[model samples]
Target: MPTDLVLLNSRLLDPGTGGLLPQTALAAADGRIAALGDDRGIGALAGPGTTVVDLKGAVVVPGFTDGHLHPVSGAERTMGVDLSACKDLASVRAALDAARRSLRPGAWLRGWGLDPNAFGEQPVGFAAVGAVLDGVPAAIDLFDAHSMLASPRALELAGIDGPRRFAQASEIVCDADGRPTGLLLEDAACALVEAVAPVPTEGELLDRTAEVLRTMAAAGLTGGHAMDGMRLGFYAELEERGELALRFRIAPWCQPGADADAVAELVRLQGTGGALWQVAGVKLFMDGTIDNGTAWLERPDCHGESTHAFWPDPQRYTEVVGELHRAGVATATHAIGDAAVRHALDAVEKARTEGGREVRHRIEHIETVPDDTVARFARLGVTASMQPTHCCEFTRADHTDNWSRRLGEERASRAFRCRDLWEAGARVVIGSDWPIAPFPPLTVMAGARHRRPSDLSLPPHGPEQALTPLQALQAYTVNPAWTACEERQAGRLAVGFRADLTVLADNPLNVRDTELRDVPVRLTAVAGRVTHRAPDVS
Candidate 1:
């Protein structure tokens, strides 16, 4: 077959063996690898119409895949002010005040990546920043997407005067006198203010989403499992315009109140998508986030919170899982706490036993599971989809961070056990649950190896749980392919695999863990299409 693209003079790294392939060049035809050999042999496969480039000895590997992410929602939420760099209350106030200045009078103020720990010993309510946003209607999403701090004006605009009930474990947190405290836990409560906030037009949002996906490709991500499917149309439109850079497998949310009909609709959504994206599974929430005190923990946090599941009735979640499993639909549930992880595993076990079948069910964010639950992941064939930076950036080694302090010492010590899960025979896939954390694939991989912020000199959190360099690489490539049941066709550099590749300035396996994130992405390609090529690459 005539080759469509060819790379010559490249060092091919086989992630499976964590070594360099003897071949110095490869060719792609019709969106799959066609041949591999020395420079002269592979170069000969490229005909007149083919595009051939000399990699100049760059290192190529299977393109990185974020096993889990939220590109569309992340772009939407973060299109506003970014408070991720704010380290203290004063910095946060300064950022918000600056953002407030940019907005027209009476315009809504929106920000994301607000770290609760910035308050130090103070409570994480809008009151902490109410003075700065006194007149502005603001909705600041905490570092965890599960909660937001709504300014008093924003709450009043949403007509949320006091506490309100929700089907899920959501809360419009109230104070001592039964007045709303401006802390909204979970989606239902946050939506109250978000609905009233300003929104971009459909065109604007689609443009931003396309831009975000391109950024991911530039960051060396060829694909991602989008944990939310709300933006299927956005992806479709991008695909239609030939702007979609990443292959996305979307799993739309099946919330707490979903009935049989809703479950059926989700099943029907499967296989519905454009060329580069598909609704292949359903997303469910076993629990919210720990930072917001909404996670379903075996024991309560220091604040007596995180004691309930996201679903009002736990058995109903199991029933839904069984129904979906019977219909051959995979599910990825957000299980952040120990109790939530246990229940999700139980639900999958029950579903498999009752249906007498197997679907590659996944549990997202197994943040603080115990010893027993770690073994069940492999036993039940559940994939642990975790974001390492969550532990790296959110918590501290000394147990001084809010997440650590809330869980006390014991539960906190088990934070992000990526290594233990992998060693227990479980298939662990790593990702950057973007918008919550940064989405750089190298940054995510560096976190798995270091177990601490790459830029910091702090002691590692649970150093025993750090993954090896090769293990971290596989988590983003081979492991995600195994989780998606595409191992036979992708996640490797062999011929017949999809022509998805990333060319780095240096071999990731050969670089220091701390230096990994700095390795320049020379080129990124998906399905033989060059999605990103650094200017120096030829």
Candidate 2:
């Protein structure tokens, strides 16, 4: 038998049952928890061969699982220039100049998180950014990753020229006279630059995956679900190399017209499974984000214009979702507006009726759900996978008014209603959607509790929607584990559960809503092996 590891003298939070036990000791042996009870008497379970870890004045909770994040995209963004930190065109130019001098000639200059709105009417043209790069081919993605601004050199490299370049679903925004304005929207941006940008070698991707896992682990996240399609091999390679440090649930990207091809590919890659990594499901996008005014709202906005659109054919989306469902795979659809959410629910209902139930399909980002649609989620047995940070970030984006005007005052109350979802008998899971939001679970917890950004002095967006600290913790822990289909084996400190846990500097149960964001992670462990330990703790 393997030697047991014991953690004692700590507050144990069981998100699964919404229970907190004071002064508990948990024992793990052979990568599984062996015992959990009051610390006063549980020490006897630690044999002579056991290694004891005194958690000493800390709170221990299950390892966090980020229900939605693009690990491959996150890693790629990490390797590229981070335009997210740039304040304006001048800063963008400065960063480009630095990247230009550092790279070899003709190398692709890539960047992520460049918001034109952040610059406030500065008219971000590729020429200005291109001049700073000394004419090297370059592409800088907007903060949303839904758009890109590329230089002429980049356009030439990608074989995009004049009006023939952009696809039907995409647009190359040009000046009134039809001159290229350097901005590529939707598929045009992804197709022209990101598609052809040299994919990192398998080894490079694996290394970066390790780095990303470490970074996330340090932030108190033990696992995450990657929602990008292009980087499937990254997860496979990490598991093959035995370098994956954190648990991962991968949801490969899905698109119209490619359902058969994607399903076949997934079948081929099905052998790549790990205790730390698994193909959670397929990811589909029903509509674009609200920040870009592309969420498919039900009714036209008060401004007398529709704020959204769909994927050309609603039936095609339903067909693809059905195919994946028939194959016994789970599905996660991104739906921010009422129309998009309804469309996704309709597809899932059709798929469920045709193929019969298999796994819990989920709708990610229910930003503006309609009043009538709340019961539909529970009726169809679909999971509401949401990101609480979105409420705060969207508030900062100043789009709440748009939602209110489009969805009506009463309908708008359903946004990010974690409590309401639970009340309606719908499973609600939380995620950071990192690279779009911060990864710290504490930040997410605080956002859920306050329903507003910490810096905002205004009253909480919807006080009725706010989750108690205990409820917020479950959203981050047990709820995500259930969504990932790992609740039984993980998400709790039970006798037979996996020994994945995080120790915090302060007990979240006692911490004030505002103080939640300030709480630091003391240590993080996976399967009895310590992965991260804060410098001053342990």
lDDT value for model 1: 0.92
TM-score of candidate 1 on Cα atoms, chains taken together: 0.99
lDDT of 2 by residue, 1-538 (tens): 4446778888888775666765478888887888777776677777887767778868899887787887777777767888766656778778878888888877888877775644544455675554675467778777766677888777777766655543124567666777676777766455767767777876777788788888888888877777876666666677676656677777777764565676677645543666677776888878776545456778755544334454667688898888778877788998887888998999999999999766689999888776678888889989998888777654433334434544556556666777787788888888888777778888888888888866655567776777888888887788887876778888887878988888997878789998898888988877776778888754
Per-residue CA lDDT of candidate 1, range 148-223, in tens?
Answer: 8888889889999998888779999898999888889999989899888989999999999989988999999999
Clashes of 1: 0
Q: Candidate 1 — which residues are off by over 4 angstroms?
A: none
Using all chains and alpha carbons, the TM-scores for the candidates as numbered come to: 0.99, 0.88
Name the lDDT value of residue 240 in candidate 2: 73
C-alpha lDDT (0 to 100) for residue 415 of candidate 1: 95
Off by over 4 Å in 2: 38-51, 86-108, 122-134, 164-168, 195-199, 240-242, 259-261, 264-272, 300-310, 397-419, 454-464
Q: Tell me the lDDT of candidate 2.
A: 0.75
